[model samples]
Target: MKYPVTVYGDPLLRKKAKAIEKDHPKLDEIIENMWETMYYSDGVGLAAPQVGLSIRLFVIDASSGADEEPELEGFKKVFINPEIIETKGDEWTMNEGCLSLPEIREDVSRHDEVTIKYLDENFVEHTETYKGFAGRVIQHEYDHLEGILFVDYLSPLRKRLLKGKLIAISKGKVRPHYRIKVPK
Candidate 1:
């Protein structure tokens, strides 16, 4: 089932998520639901908090059902309790959007490469490095687990300019293509 994405202004998005145990119940089902919800929303990545859950779990499919990036083709995976071990490389700016913060895209600066340690859906541990679009997608989703939104990386002036739009989103004034759970 596709879960209603938690929208901006939800307090849950500000709280850091708890790491799930290796044998957490219904882990498989939750992962499957996340995939369904993400694909249904046309999102490249998604986090648990975005679905009203406070768990350190997320899914990413940088391919986005397209062949835009040959390197990202078939690059889909589930990250459970992920931790960034290292981030090395020049920072690059990319236009980023979030499922929670609809209709607000920003050029955010991020490292071009990242090395992360995380678990698969079955709790198998792995450490890997990613670059280019895949790295950007992973970093973006990983930030959600730490209660960091892409908007937070914007400059104060830029944020001030977007303050009204952000508030509108919080008040459920924005309309996204997919289902969202606006904060009450």
Candidate 2:
């Protein structure tokens, strides 16, 4: 199923997500639906909150071509209740965008490599290290689980200039009836 993506300024996008308690009836279905929604939208990642779900879940597949590396193949990954256990090295700046924010893209600084601990789709625990573009995608999707958007990293001046546009987006002026609601 292709779920609706909440746009910028949606209250649900600002609220931190709650951790998934256990393997539930619709968990697997939701993951599958999210992947379908993400691929349909040409997004590298999709968080539960983006689809108006408040659970701490997100999907990432960074197997796309990067500016530095063009021949990279993508991989599909799902992170449930994920945490960055370790991060090393200096920050790298990359132009980042979000599915929720539509066409907006901004330069954001993130760690070049990270080690993350997360629960997989089958409820198995795993820890893996990622570098380069994969690392960036992980960090980006992880931020969504915490209610952080890529625009939050923008400069104060730029943010101020974009405030009206963001507000209009949130209010559904630009894309009416497309916003999804977070389940209470």
Q: lDDT tens digits, residues 1-184, model 2?
A: 8898878877788888988866566998999999988888888889999998888899987777555665346567889999889888789999887878765678899888899999998778999998888888888888888889988888899999888877766665564333343222
Instruction: Indicate which candidate wins on TM-score.
Output: 1
Residues 80-162 of candidate 1 have per-residue lDDT tens digits of 99999999899999899999999999999999999999999878999999998999989999999999999999999999999
The clash tally of candidate 2 reads 1
CA lDDT of each prediction against the hidden true structure? 0.92, 0.81
User: What's the lDDT of the predicted structure labeled candidate 1?
Assistant: 0.92
- Badly placed stretches (over 4 Å) of model 1 are 65-68
Error of 2 at 148 (Å): 0.8
